[model samples]
Target: MPPIPTPLTLTQLLNPPSRDGLLTQIVSMLSGLGFSATDWETDSDGRIILQVEAQTLADLWQAVYKIAQGGYLDTATGDWLTLLAQSQYQLTRNPPTQTIGEFRLTAAGGVGPYTFNKGDLVVTYFDPTQNNKALIYRSTNAAPVVVNPGTTRSIQVTADSPGSAYNIAPGSVLVLNTPRPGLTVDNQGTLQPAVATGAILNGPFFTAGQTLIVTSALNGGAAVGPTTFTFTADYPDMTSVANALNVLIAASPQAGRITANVLNGALSLSTILITGATAVDQITIANTGTANISVGFDTGSATSVSGAYSWISEYGQDNESDTSLITRCINKWATIGTGTKAAFISWATSADPDVQKVAVYSNLFNGTPKAGAVTLYIAGIGAFDIVSGPVHANNVYAYIFPKLPIMTELFVAPAARNTKDVVFTAKIKTQYNNDTTKNAVFNAVQNLFFRLTIGETLYKDQVIAAIITIPGIVDATLSAPGIVSDIVPAINELITLGSVTPNWLVVV
Candidate 1:
């Protein structure tokens, strides 16, 4: 090489340089110096205004070289100029270094006996991560003084006390010294007394129906009466008094009458009576006939005073009556008697004259009948059977009136027949009967018996849906509807089968 040309000084290269070209040339130089350039902005006259980083200066220089080789020397020169100016500006504007200090008080030294007044702030250096050094300083101190490094020292400084006095230095923290004694219940399972002077009771106690007495002494030296205080009973296990009472009511009756035992401070029942034919747990009765019979219940023996009593007059009579043909005829028509027998009798008498006999026989097929009769009447016609002795062992000796003619008069014709009407009516009647019978049976099984009606007319077409006689089973499914059917069958089945044992079955 003949001679090496000296590189231009930064100032010399840029002496009176064009502000427009300066940024570009500086950026190109920076790219060569290993700084990245991302973006560049220029003034309207092409002076570089801003430059950003996107790649390392070495990479940028390589890119610029490629561009220069591609005949983009102007772009390359502009980039170099921008980078040089930015580097020189940064060097001229370096930031000052920050100063910090660290100090610690001897462990023996704490917030002082020496007080600091208001408007005085003590300067302290502390590692935020470590405990602070306790320092004492005055508001009037002329200059900052370094505290003895390792020893505990009290530096006297005068300071005015602030209204809300607190001792805190610039880096010295404060810890609370106020007492924080926890409160707690002293007595549990009992009521707490009223808080009095100097009383320090705090609570978490179990108090149920506990009475507390509070007494106060008057300023005049007179003693006040003790004021009674009570804590409400909290029965988490049982809901309410009424609810508990209901539960008690629902529980099986204790073997005693419900008697208010004044002596025991409680309500209870008398001892169960265990004696006699009438020995019963309970009893119920319903009188359907015109005659009213008195029921004498001896709570002592749990027995009925009346022996062999009839629940329904018609049923009782029909049950005892002779089963003779003439007696049957009379029963089938005699005022439609009282219970189911009466019901059957009305049904038989209501049929057409030609159909009456057949209806009577059909009604009696599965029914109980009277014993006997000497004279039989058919459609108001009498037919006397001359018997030397009693016609039947349990025969009726007197006259047996025939059933009245079925609608001899037009005005007495039965209501118009509607299949729907019949079905609905029959269903309703049957349901009523069954319900009544069930109620009665339930009562009887519970040693409580009662009687209900089977209505004036029997639903001849109604079929028996079921006959449940399960022992100890109170609920029974009945084909019929209301009270009558329920009571009669349940009672009779219970009595006859001796299987069903429940004294009562409450229907829903």
Candidate 2:
């Protein structure tokens, strides 16, 4: 039989005598040296001057033990652990990063080129689960500001603070708190305006050569322009001018279904062009003609209801935990080569705060392993697809390219998601209501899936334990997963949470 090795801490390995034994020895030696207990005051532990002497010696031994422990990865604690990571691998704790989202702005029937400036504020609704706290996001200077030739514009916003809590769903942040009236966040889909629609232009005919310029949404939107008839006939009346412009538009084969009308000196230009296309037609009266008059085209007011939706570009991350930091620091040991698999994993994770999981493989395209060929499969905080995923792939490639080993073929890709349905039937204790207990069971299932790493297996036993251990669930059986043992994913796949179907109402 082989012998089992005993565990040893630095303090234990030193074989230092007990504090009590040391105290007793000190007291005995002092007594022999003719010192009396009355000479030194006694503490609550019933020791005299001997106690202080014994404790000081014990502390010295512990100091030596801690110093030795600090030099090793397995035994170091707190700030000492941080120092080892810093000095050895140049690694610091990962800081939390803020999420960047694209917030769009729209105004119905408005003027040209509206600007939503940098530092504009947008916020999420107060969530009850977060103690009624609302997250704020601000527009960066890089956000687009021009609304020229169109009434809708999109802008970029950064979360006010760094944290995963700000990685909210699309359309969740609709409050543009920057005080821009009539400009909205993510409701542009509701406006439902027709094709080639233009806001009414308030005007009486200005001059002999005044003309309206029309741009179509057909055949790549060729412009239809300057009427050939009755140069001054429509002058001095807005309705006459609109009717005249309508004639010119009708004369052009391009403006097939376009219409123009005037009411109270406002000329409205619109087209019922083709249904189902959701048009982008423009009715700007061009000032390029011989008429010396100013022109203002008003597209109707539009809220962002239809035009605005935000998705996380760079997902925010929570501060790294001690365990994750320690694991990374250990991986740094393998990164000294800059070409090892560990190096790839370490650098890929460090590429972005949102990169939560990374899977590394050699020559995934070929069945046989090819030397120096590596592909990294990584996932962001939420909703990253490989073929059409966000910038996580770009961010990773940019970061890892320069750091790669010479002549090594490296490919970085977002991990493909493997979504699965969570279904279960459970027996519940009568004292606990089925609805509340069923919800708890689903939460347990979600938690299990949530904690799973990329490419990890989902075991049936784990599911059983999770549900059965719940306070109200007496037992549970898995269903609809096609197997009762375990669900496994490909090496390049990540398990994403899907729909949950819990049939907990049945008594059995």
Candidate 3:
């Protein structure tokens, strides 16, 4: 090409020579190559201080190299500049450390060791004390644990503890791989070791044949087995008495069977009827192939049954055995006319009456006759004179019996004497005529009524207030007053009966 460009000397590049003369020369050369210098600082002992910024690391490296060749290197006096120059050159040749985010060492039974590439920023923690105090070796150097990147090689390590940490290789992670197997419980409440090879058994001691109720946190169960020194003798009888009892307790009423006196020869079961309106008596038993039994009514055991029978008669009446009544009373009445006598009769009666005698009867009638002697004497001659006999006047009078008025008042008292100011609404019926010829008439019937009363007052108001409205009132004439006259008075009576004051009347 042409003659090579002459290299400028340090003295010539830094014309105004001083302690920081190389910094000026380096900055001038870098600026000429399109680099900017910033954040410049120098030590007390005068030395060139400079920092240059470029678009990229590559651009920065190129600018550095160019400045070094342009007589700036001759001006550099310290070892730091040399090191910095070497480091800069190495960075330009390799990819950035930030590009490699993380690295992991994967080791399996089949897969051996491998390594990550250079410039990797990896996260790893290792304790050499745990791994036989083995030092990490790379290439030819014995290295302490370092975070920087370099050449790749397999990492080797050994465990210090043979039992706890043995066979633990470097880069190996600990994982809880499997769960513990089920444990066997003995009658003595001792837990046997888990069957799984890698399982760990932790327990409290138990007694032999004393019934081991094993309750598992994972599966709900009471495991029962014999307490033996050997594992073979710890066979679990899942269907044993203790086990069955546990199962029965765990199972729901729908699924389980309950037996009383399981071991004893004698057993009795008392059951209440599950359905039907009438009371019934019955017993049920399940043999379970373990016991024989006899069941009968034991009169001697009546005392044991007494409490239950009394309970049945009281609150437990629904469970009682139905019995026949000794005697029943039937009231008798003459049934004289329209069977009204029966309503007036008391329940007690000595004898029954004949039905036909009082069935029906007609009203009697009579006629008057004239005297015969006077008629014979006046027949011929005295026809003129006999006509003067006394004249008789005929008249008929009808006597109507008026019905007496029957007045009835209902009274409601609170069950407790102290209860007061109870408010309630009620319905009442009235018998307008004492003849008892018609049904009681009522008015203004409503379903819901307010109450401020307590106990019996609460009940009485609710009952009497239930109005009965009949379609017809006995002997009710169109010209007479409406049926309300009777209803209003009855309601007033009921209100007084309920002892509900005006202030307490919440609403009707």
In terms of TM-score, the best-performing candidate is 2
lDDT of 2: 0.56
The residue-by-residue lDDT of candidate 1 on 13-64, one tens digit each, is 2233333344456666666778664343434222232222212333444554
By summed lDDT, the worst window of 10 consecutive residues in model 3 runs over: 392-401
Model 3, TM vs. native: 0.10
Ranking by TM-score: 2, 1, 3
After TM-score superposition, what is the CA distance of residue 232 in candidate 2 from its true location, in Å? 53
Q: After superposition, which runs of candidate 2 have C-alpha atoms over 4 Å from their true positions?
A: 1-22, 31-46, 52-65, 96-319, 365-371, 380-389, 434-440, 479-486, 506-508
Error of 1 at 48 (Å): 97
Model 1 ranges off by over 4 Å: 1-275, 278-500, 503-508
Tens-digit per-residue lDDT, 227-343, candidate 3: 111111222331233243334344433122222221111122212222221111212112211111011111111101100000000000111111100010111222223123231
Prediction 1 TM-score vs. true? 0.12
Query: How accurate locally, in lDDT, is each candidate?
Result: 0.23, 0.56, 0.20
Cα RMSD (Å) between model 1 and the true structure?
47.7
TM-scores for every predicted model: 0.12, 0.51, 0.10
The predicted structure with the larger lDDT, 1 or 3, is: 1
| Global Cα RMSD, each model | 47.7, 18.6, 53.8
